[model samples]
Target chain A: MVTKFRTTIAALAASTILATSAFAGELVINTDTSDPAPKAAFEQLIADFEAANPDITVKWNLFDHEGYKTSIRNFLTADAPDLANWYAGNRMLPYVNAGLFEDVSDVWEENGLNESLASAAGSMTIDGKKWGVPYTYYQWGVYYRKDIFEANGIEVPTNWDEFKAAGATLTEAGVTPITIGTKYLWTAGGVFDYLNLRTNGYDFHMALTKGEVEWTDPRVVDTMNNWKELIDAGFFLENHSSYSWQEALAPMVADDAAMYIMGNFAVAPLREAGLTDDQLGFFQFPVINPDVPLAEEAPTDTLHIPANASNKEDARKFLAFLATADVQTKINETLGQLPIHKDATVGDDKFLQAGYAMLSSTDGGIAQFFDRDAPAEMAKVGMEGFQEFMVKPDRLDAILARLEKTRQRVYK
Target chain B: MSASRASRFNQRSLAPVLFLAPAVLFFLFYVIFPIFQSIQISLYDWDGLGPKTYVGVDNYVELMDDEAFYTSLKNNVIWLVLYMLAIPAGLFIALFLNQTVFGMRLYKSLFFFPFVISQVVVGLVFTWFYDPSYGLLNVILGWFGMGPIAILGDETWVTYGIIFAGLWPQTAYCMILYITGLNAVDPEQIEAGRLDNAKGWKMLWYIILPQLKPATFIALVVTVIGALRSFDLVSIMTAGGPWGSSRVLAYYMYEKAFSEYGFRMGYGAAIAVVLFLIMMIYITFFLVKMYRDEKGL
Candidate 1:
């Protein structure tokens, strides 16, 4: 009786495998964003794709950020998704080197995504092969409370001395100059990158992330020292460590904090906190030294497919659909992120509008987010070094030396 | 007839093996095999998906010099040592409620409530409890004319604060176990100890504690394992932050394997192997005690 039951189960397993392989019917997609509106939009696109290709059915799996990372890693080692959403910068580099993601250069050309989002497409390409389409992109810069500035009679600064003077002005009025949460570590790095860009230039920033220059180098040392000076001046909120980026916004909303150096995604939260357009403002992170060449703010996001995808053709179609103006506009409207497609309609999201203007002005010089532009291993070490410097400003040399060692190990 | 009788003896012995087949298979497939696989993975350099490069002992060697690794190890030691205080603390509470009193059962249930709820809920509750502005702890501290202290933000206090939150449930669990043990304590032995003028701490140490050995053993086993397996509370509460001061070996291993950081599966497995070795030390002691008890039985 046991033998009969075992034989029946074996027969069923063989038949299921044979049926799935024979039909060429199933398409699986994985994504990280769990926002309801964006998820619903993606599902609608999936429905349209299924309708267009009667023989194919798309299986959608969406996971929140943390679980998405774990599930994607597990899936890559087992059954990979046909299409996946991933970060483009250093995040994709490890998987690309491991040959886990497919080389979709042909699809990039066939679908015209290369010409559509040339700058973003360039970042997605490594070693002259494009690995993914960029669905959305955004800029990072200073978002300050206009009401506080107005109340304090301070103008936005466009240079290093003026920025410091503004910090001084805000401090005199008993308002904290910047609200940041270094608990996550990345928030502190965002400030460091902006400072580095201002102090040296985008090229030097690129060089540091690429590990061509030691973090202990004079340029890096000067940048850290500048941040330490700001910190010593009591420029940041008191409870920065206990607050997340969102939580830090509370003091800003209450007019206790004056400015936040953040990306465009922070705009929605500002609006949700009841800040009007006139009450808020932004600026390109000031150029600290005039000798360093000026460049644009960061632009980065991702859209990619796996190498082991069973439905490669369907994945290409999905990439094309995502690159379309309609889909990009829908995503931008729902997510409050800038569309990679130039033709996509811009929403009333002021931060995203500012991002579009800033990005359009710089044609030749665009850098991805520091962490995204660099390898993940180095980014992790570098961010930790950033936090260490933030906490113990006097340990600048030690932190830089440790990061230099990590860069040496990682880059080699 | 002699040959047939020998075959019958073999068949009877095989029947007992068949009875234990399911349990043996389950343990092998789930618990035992995964441990061996983890050790095998530790020897390779794999990003989890691609071809694993054989890098024997390199991961372990690098881990030795890793500052974050050492910090995590030190933090785990602090957690284990501090977490053991729950046992004596629980015993005290158990004694307080051990007497015949009104609503004793209800009081015991309320005391055991923390153990019944999920750890995630406990973490969230404690996070609010320690919140600098709105938390109950800070509000109560304010009555003494004290300013709000950044419990989670301050690196020096973050790990200790998390351990305090952890003690909430751990003490409750130990209390319930001790209450059961207290009920089973021989009344005659207590009366004999009382007549000999043994009371208070002396009575507890010489008389009651010796009789509560089984409960104490179970409590220690659970506490040690709980301390080592403490990932969820730390993850939900601090995420090894306030400048990575709260990171334990378990949380750090998960972070290395699949966070925004590099997915160095082999490196992560090596960390797991270290954690396992640390755990095995306590597990060995527990097994020996159990073995001795079994022999005595």
Candidate 2:
């Protein structure tokens, strides 16, 4: 009886293996795009990729945005898919350093992405080698009410003095100069990035994020003082911490607030809230120090093949296809983001055109936003300190001291 | 014949053990093994995927100075103390509704509705209720010219705001438990108390209370566990935010492990071990009480 049972179990296992291997030629892709537009764009890309590659089948897995963050590490180590969607910069560094992500420099060379995807190459590269391919990125800048600026006879500011003058003019007209919401904490990080980028320049900000420079460095102090000047001018919306980024836009839509420093994703929401393109405008964050080169915050999204993937060859083919200007244009146009490939056709929307122009004109290199540039541990404490500083600028010394301690512990 | 009798004896002894094997194996693998694994993992420096380096007691040492840890610990205490209010409040509601009024069954179910919904939903509903500008709570306060208070944003009031949300469902749960317990109360015993003129508080204190001891014990156990495991509300409503002021141990452990802060597996396990030890103290006390009761019986 025992021999018969063992033989039967072996037969069942053999049949299961045979059944699974029947479809072994398929390539699996995992993505986290929970929003409707991005999800639709991803589905369209998948359909297109499948239509283009008739020999290989694609197995796609979709996950909600937050759930994917925790599940990615486990799946990468245990049951890695052919390709996974991830963010660029410090967010991808841990996986790259751990050897979980396959280096895709060959894909870059084969596709000649060096020239086509030049703007995004810096963010995707670590240790002088590119680990992933960037598909889309959006620009962050000062989005303002054009009608309000025109009505007040305020020209778009190009430097710190002019910026403050604009704020003063808006305040005199009984409008909030700048609207922000720090309840989720990352919005404050955006402001801090622009401030650091404009004050100390891009190199100093990179070094600061990588833990090479202390938070209490006088240069950082100078950045904080510049931010404090705006706070003391009573230029920002009062009780801004009570609102999320979406809620903070209410004042801007109501004409009570004049400008918001945010990402291009805010455009769709602005239009939904009854603001016309003629009523809105975009500008680069004004330069704080003429000596410091102008850098911009542009967080890019990337795709990578896991090291343990079974279909690495097919994954490479998919990535190369994704990097082409045609594929990128379709994806970005659907998702309403800037395509990484320089030759990709941009949307006819004015905002997209403005963002492309601003990015092309950036003198210094791009740095991912504060959270994406710093290690997550450091980013958490750093964003918290930024929020606290905004609320109580008098606690500058104490907050910086605490942040320095955290940086030492985290980076060590 | 003697050999056959010995085989039968052996089979009788082994039958019960064979029948119980699957459950015991499951408990060992799922519960016991993870506890020991977590204890082992706590002594290392690991980021979930990388090779672990033994860090001795460094994680614990770091946790000692961690202001966030202390804040979570203090909030846990506040949660425990305020969470006990659910029991009394539930009992009061249960007593008030224990009657033969018109549509009492409908009233009972309606009163218990909050407990039936998932905690995540309750959290979202309360988040809107406490919104600083347009929430119902503030709108009502506006009538008195009092509050446009940002409950979730203010550090001092954030923990209280979350606890109050947690209590809404927890109190309803306790009320349901007591209502079931009240159903089993002996009518003869109540009549005997009435003959002795045991009315109102006297009757409840002396007669009804002792009979409800079993229900009270269950309520205490669940309420304590619920308070310690208060993660969903904190995650959904405040995210332990306005500067980590509203964090409890469970949410803090999750934040350290899986949040954007990167996975510090060893540090996160250390936190879990500490929470487990704290919970074990209460479990031991309850077990001792249960053991004593069994012995007396």
**Candidate 1 structure lDDT:** 0.82
Candidate 2 wrongly placed segments (more than 4 Å)? A1-25, A169-174, B1-12, B192-197
User: In order, what DockQ does each candidate have?
Assistant: 0.55, 0.46
Per candidate, chain B TM-score?
0.94, 0.96
Top DockQ hit? 1
Record all residue pairs in model 1 with backbone atoms less than 3 Å apart, i.e. clashing.
A90-A372, A102-A307
Model 1 per-residue lDDT tens digits across residues B7-48: 899789987898889999999987898798789888988766
Q: Which regions of candidate 1 fall more than 4 Å away from where they truly are?
A: A1-27, A43-58, B1-12
Q: Model 1 residue B77 lDDT?
A: 100
Task: Tell me, by lDDT, which candidate is best.
Answer: 2
Model 1 interface DockQ: 0.55
Interface RMSD value for candidate 1, one decimal? 5.2
Model 2 Cα lDDT, one tens digit per residue, B189-285 = 9999999999999999988878888889999999999999999999998878877788899999999987867589889999999999999999999
For candidate 1 chain A, which ten residues in a row score worst on lDDT? A14-23
Instruction: Assess every candidate by TM-score.
Output: 0.92, 0.93
